[model samples]
Target: MKNTTTPPKIVALALLVFVGAVMLGYGVSRMSAQEPQGNPVTGGLLYDKWWTVTGADAPVGDHPLWATQSTNTRTGADTWRCKECHGWDYKGADGAYGSGSHFTGFPGILAIKGQPVADIVAALKGSTNPDHDFSAVLDGQALLDLAVFVSESLIDTAPLVNADKTATGDAARGQAFFAMCTACHGPQGNAIYFDSFEDPLVIGSLSSDNPWEFIHKARYGQPTFLAMPALYTLGLADSDVGDVLAYAQSLPGEPALSGGGLLYDKWWTVTGADAPTENHPLWATQSTNTRTGADTWRCKECHGWDYKGADGAYGSGSHFTGFPGILDATSKSSEELLAWLNGEANPDHDFSVVVDEMALDALVAFIQQEMFDISMYVNEDGTVAGDADAGRSLYAGTCARCHGADGKIYNFGSEDKPEYVGTLAVDNPWEVFHKVAVGQPGAPMPGALALGWTPQQIADVVAFAQTLPVE
Candidate 1:
C-alpha cells in the first residue's frame, strides 16, 4: 500500500526514519548489557601482587604457565607474581626481562593496550591459552579490574628508566618528596632490610639496581605493605616519580650495619627468636654480673656496651662480666669469625645454637665494620675529645630536628627517672658514638656515616649532646 500511494521522496524519508529508530534501539540495548568499569588503580596493584591486593593467601605451587619458562628460577609466591612473567616495562620478551635471570620468553600486553575489554577479559579467562586461565585464583570482578587496567592504565616505561637503571630527574626536588619515606626507610633508605640481615639489601640498593621495578612499586605501592604511599594515587606527576628515583639512587647502598648493632643489643629481639632458656654456654665463666636469662644471652652483656668488656663500662659495675670483648674480633678475618660463631673454634663461644647463619654473619659484619676503637674519642672520664663549639653548630643543624633545640625532647627513661640524649652521651659516650656512626636500629635515626660525616664529626655531635639537660 505504501509503494502504491506514497511518492519516492516520502518512501525514502520513512525508510531512513525506520532504520534510524532501529539503530538507536540497538545502541541502547548494547549499552544496557555492558558492565560498569572496574577500578584501574586496584587493577594496577593487583597486577603487582594479586594476593596482597585481594587479601588472599598466595596460591600454592607454581602457576600453570610457569612450567613453560625455565630462565627465572624463583619458586613459590614469587613465580605467581604477574611482573615475573610480564616485564616491569610491560614489553615482556622484547624488554628488560627478555633475557638474563628474569627471562620468561612471554609476549607482553603493551601491544593490546587499546583492545576491547571483553576480549582482554576473555584472554585472561584462558580463551587464548587454557594454561593462562586466572579464573581459578581470581573472581569475576578481579578479572574485570585487571581488564580495565590493561585497557586503560598501562604505560610505556621505556622512556622512563634508562639502560643503566638510572632515571633523569632532579635530586633536590626528590629529596624533599622523600621526607614522607623517612619514617620507615630512614634518611638514607637503609632502615628496612629487604633480604636477610647478611645480604642487607635495602630500598636504596633496590632503587639503584632496578629503577623500573622501583618506579612500579612507587606508583602502585608495595603489596602486603598497604601503608606504603603510592605516588600515583597521591597525584604525583611522572617527572616527580623520576625525581624520587633519582634521590633514592643517590642514597647510600651499603649493608645496614645498624641491623647488626640491633642484633648485638638483643639478638632474640631483632631476630624474633625465643630467648634461650638456659644461660649462654660462656655465662658460667663470668661471676660478677648477677643478670640471668635473656640478659645473659646478649652480646653486649659479654662484650660490654663499649665493646671493651672488662676494660670498659661493664668492667666492674652491676653489668660487669669477666668475658672478653669483641672489639679485637674486628682484626680477624670473616672466615675466622664465622668459625667462632658456628662453633668451629671454641664450642662454648658458638652463637649458632640460638641464631641463624645470616644473623651470625650480621654480627661478624658489625664487628668488622662498626666496632671502631672509640678510646680516641671517649676518654676514661666519660668526656669527649671533640670541638664542643663546632659540634653545637652541627647538632643545632641536624640532631636538633629530632632531639629538640635543647636536646630534651625525648625522655628515654620514665617520667620519674627521666633520661634525655644528654644522659646517654654523658653516661656512655662509647654507645653514643656507635649509635651516631651506624644509626639506631629499628628506628628512623640517621647515621653520621650515611650522612658522609667523619669520625671527628660524629665525636663532635656526641660532645654537643653531652651538654644537653640530663634530667
Candidate 2:
C-alpha cells in the first residue's frame, strides 16, 4: 500500500508491455492472411510469354517501359517479353543481349534473386516505377508467379557458360540426354528448319551462336511450341542442361541432304506449291499406276523411294512403270542432272516447269551425296544382311520410342490392311533401307544418315525391325 501509489515507473512498464503484445498480434494476423505463394514453373513459362499461358490476347500496343529503350527495334508483343529486355541469360545489357539486335539498355532481374518475395510482387505491381508495372495484363496470382520466378528460379548462367559461347560441362554426358531430343530434332540436330529455306537454321548452329538463348530454351519449353519438354520440370540440374548444350553444339550444321530427301518424296509439298491439276507429260507412258493428276508429278512416283524405279520396290506393284531407275544416274555430273531436269536430256521428263533451280540442285545433291545402294544391306528376299543381335540395342534406343517395342503402334497402310513397321520391314526392305537412311518425308522420324550411323548400323536396325510381328 505504501509503494503502490508512488510507482510511476512500474505503471509505465505495464503500459509498454500491453502495446508490444498488441503489435505482435497484428503482425501475425497480417502474415496469416497473405495469399499463397505462386508456382515457379508456371512463373518461368509466364516470363517467356504470359498471354500464351493465360490464353489472353496479347497486348495491342507496346509495353509502357518499351518507350524507354530505343536500341531494340522490335515492336508490340516482342517488346513486352521479359527476356527481350533482360536477356535470355537474365543479365540484360551485361549479358548476351549487350550488343546484338536485342540489346535494350535495361537491367536484369538477377539482382533480385533471393530477395523477399513480397517485395518483388510489389515491384511488379508498380510500387517502384509505374512504367515497370504489369498489373494491367496479369492478375494477382500471375504477378506473384513472376515475382517468385525472379526471386527463386533465376540462375546466373555466367559460371555455366563461357565467354566464347561454349558450355562448361561434359559433352559425353550431354549426348546421353540428347537421345530424348532425337525424335523431334534428328541426331545431327537438323530435322526442323527454323529460318527461311534459302538460309536455313538448326539447333547445332543456334547453340553455337547463342549459348545463352539455348540454355534458356532448354530449361524452359519453347514459347509457342507446347510439345517441347522443359528440362527443368523433368528434373534436369543446371549442370545437366549445360552438358546437353555442349553436346548439341557439336552436331552437324545445315541440313541440305535432308531437305533434298524431303523434296524427293513430294516436291510440291516441300516447295509450298499447289499441286498441278494436270497429269505429268509422261503419265501416258505408264498404265499400271492408275494414279493421275498430282500423283504422277512426284519424283518418287517415277524414280521410286529406293531410287531404283522399275528395278526395285516399284517394279511389280500397282505403282509399277517402265521408267528406268535413277540409281545409275547418280554417277552423272551436276550439270548433266540439271540438263535432264531442264529438258535438255528428255523434254518429257522436264521438272524445271514445276520446281525452281535451287530444288533441282538439291535433287542433284541427294542423288550424288545421300543415295545409298540398298542392295548391299537388303537381300532380294526382303531380308537384311545385318547382325540382328547388334541391331536390337540400336533399335531400342533410336526407333523403339515412336514405333513402339513391337513396332505396331503406327499403321502406315489402311486400318484393315494395317501396314506396321514390322510389315514394311518384311515386305519392302529396300524401301525400309531408303527411309531409314534419309528419314520419312515430312515426318519427325530420324534417319540414320542424319544420325551419322554406319551402313551396318542401319542394316542392324532393319534386321531387328524384321523380327517384329507383321500382323
Best by TM-score: 2
- Taking all chains together, the TM-score of candidate 2 against the true structure is 0.70
Give the winner by lDDT: 2
Tens digits of per-residue lDDT for model 2, 1-471: 122111344334333434544553465457547846676656788888889988889878788888888988889998888888888888999888889799888988888899998999999888899788888889998888788888887878887788898889889999777765765576577866665445767888888888887887777666566545566655678898889999989987786254677778777867778888999999998788899899998888888877788888778879999788888887899999889888999999898888888888888888888887787888767778998877877776557656878988778999789998989998888778878887776465656777667778888889988999999
lDDT of candidate 1 over 1-471, digit per residue (tens): 011112344335334534654564465457647855565556778899899889898888888888888888888888887788887877788988888998989888888798899998999899999988999889988898788878876777766678877878888888766765654466677755665444567778888888878888877677666545566655567888888888999988865454677788777766667778888878888788888888888877888767888888777779877777777788999999999888999988788888887788778888888767788788888899988877876675457656777878778789899888999899888878877776665554666665556788878879888998887
Candidate 2, residue 336: how far the Cα is off, in Å: 1.8
Instruction: Provide the global lDDT of candidate 2 against the true structure.
Output: 0.78
**lDDT (Cα atoms) of all candidates against the true structure:** 0.76, 0.78
RMSD per model, one decimal = 18.0, 17.0
The TM-scores of all predictions, comma-separated, are 0.59, 0.70
Q: For model 1, where is the 10-residue window of minimal lDDT?
A: 1-10
lDDT of 1 at 13: 36
